[model samples]
Structures are given as structure tokens and as C-alpha cells.
Target: MQFVIRKLSPNDRLSIVTFSDDAQRLCHLRSMTQASKAHLEDLVDGLGVINMTNMEAGLKTGHQILDGRHSNHKVHEHT
Candidate 1:
């Protein structure tokens, strides 16, 4: 839940920069208007959420793998 506000006075200016990707996708802002900026910010926030979810899922999977290995080790020792 972050807010972004960009205000450029008549004298102020802005520039946009982008790099080429393997997919040959062109990424550029459609406009510098308030609504566009808000939309872009929302997209960024969504990406953050997705990234965190992936990280948490990975951690859980790792823990499960480790627990399985440890359990197998203990059972072998008892036998």
C-alpha cells in the first residue's frame, strides 16, 4: 500500500530510459499523467507481492526436503 505522486512544474522536465530484452519487448510509459503514474505504481506493487510469494514458497519446499532427508537418516540408524 504505497502511494506515488509525480508533479512536474512547467519548467521541470523528465526523461525515460529503457533497455532491450531477449523477448524484444518495448517498455515505455504511455504518459506522465497522474493516472498513468498510479497505474504503473500499482503494477510494481503487484510484482513485489508475486516475488514475495515465490520466495516463501521456495523456503517451504526447501524445508520439506531437508525434513525428509533427516527422517530417512534417523530411520536407517535405528534399523
Candidate 2:
């Protein structure tokens, strides 16, 4: 797993993080605080990692459901 993080602005406390899988596919994009040491630590900890994995799975499932609904809609339109 790899992540790329960049500050939204020089004077801002927000940053954008791009999380990539082993194959270099972008799996997740998120905004986080740049000034919170505890939050940052939690993100790298074991529990946080597990939570992130679960969230990723949920996100993928959501996309699949949305795609199915979109495809169904297209079919109904053609009928």
C-alpha cells in the first residue's frame, strides 16, 4: 500500500491523500487534517488500518450497487 499526501494550501490545515493499491491503482481519495498529530498516528495504527480496509470494501460495494441501478435504468429506458 502507498499514499501520496499534499497540503490543500500553504496556510490551510487540510490535506488530500491518495491511497494506492499494490498495482498502483488509486483506491481511495480523502481529505485530512495536516496539523493533527494524534489523528495522523491513528491512521497508521493497526485498528485504523482495519477500519480503512472495511471502509474501502463498503465503498466498492456502494459503487457496484450504483452501477447496477444505472444499468437497469438504461435498460428500462430502451424498453
Candidate 3:
């Protein structure tokens, strides 16, 4: 995660998609900045292992998040 954060440019946008059997959603999207980067760092620090593994549900949720992002940025003209 740290590596990912480091590789992001200031113009980059990122969203965190978290999932579990009982809960799944796009945590949020933020532009990379000093504060935003710190926010990502904090999120990573607070992470905990989910004992209930549900890969299918997690993937579905992630796909939904990506779809939403794509739709939301349609004006940006995603090809």
C-alpha cells in the first residue's frame, strides 16, 4: 500500500474499496496531496485482517465501485 501511495502523482485520483461479507463499499476517493496522502497512510495504518474471507463479494463490490467512478467521471470522457 505504501508503495502504491508513493507511486501516485499529485494529479492522481484514488479510491479505497473495502469489502466483507457483511459490508462492502467504496470508502472514498481523494486527490493526491500532502493531506490526502496522509489520510491514505492513516487508513492503511488502521487496517485489520478480515477473518471472514469473501473474495467473490469483494470483487463484486470493487467492480461496482469502478463502475460508479466511471459513470461519475463520464463528463471527463473516459474511453
Candidate 4:
């Protein structure tokens, strides 16, 4: 996750969401600048153990994050 985040350009808007028993949208479409990356890295540090393995919720939240980007967005989440 850190590697992926680091690769994003400053112009890119990045969102981080984690799932366990549920899904959490830690940050949403924030500019990928150095300071913002540091802040987001700190947010990533907050992630700990999770439960239930609810992948559906994770994918749903991801789609929600990217929602207005596409007109026809149909997604599937399989456990």
C-alpha cells in the first residue's frame, strides 16, 4: 500500500480505504503531495487488525470513492 501510494503523482487524487468487519474511507481524493502523502502515511499507520473479512464492503466503499468518475459503473465484490 505504501509503495502504491508513494508512486502517485502530486496531481493525482488518492483515496485510501480499508476493510475488515466493515470498510473505512480514511482519506478521500486528497492531492498526492509530499505533505499530504506524509499525512496519509500517518493515517495508514492507524490501521490495525481487522475482522469478518468483508470484501464486499471494501469494494463498495472503493466504488463510492470513485463514483462520479464514470457514468456506467457496475462493480462486483466476491469473497
- Which predicted model would earn the best lDDT? 4
Which candidate order results from sorting by lDDT in descending order? 4, 3, 1, 2
Winner on TM-score between 1 and 3 is: 3
Q: Per-residue error at 43 for model 4, in Å?
A: 1.3
- What TM value does model 3 have? 0.68
Candidate 2 per-residue lDDT over residues 5-74, each given as its tens digit = 3434334332212222211112222244454433444444422232122335344434544444212111
Distance from true location, Cα of 75 in model 2, Å: 27
Count clashes in each candidate, considering only residues at least 3 apart in sequence or on different chains.
0, 0, 0, 0
Q: What is the TM-score of each candidate against the true structure?
A: 0.29, 0.21, 0.68, 0.76
Which regions in candidate 2 have their CA more than 4 angstroms from the true location? 1-30, 36-38, 48-79
Cα lDDT for residue 61, candidate 2: 39
Clashes of 2: 0
Report the lDDT of model 4 for residue 59.
75
Best-to-worst order by TM-score is: 4, 3, 1, 2
Worst 10 residues of 2 by lDDT: 70-79
Q: Which pairs clash in model 2? A: none
TM-score: which candidate is best?
Answer: 4
Q: Per-residue CA lDDT of candidate 4, range 1-79, in tens?
A: 7787789898888877777766777766778999988988888887787566777877787778788442223333456
How does candidate 2 score on lDDT? 0.31
Candidate 3 C-alpha error for residue 36, in Å: 1.0
In candidate 3, which residue pairs clash?
A: none
Residue-wise C-alpha lDDT for candidate 3, range 32-65, written one tens digit per residue: 8878888887887777777665666555555656
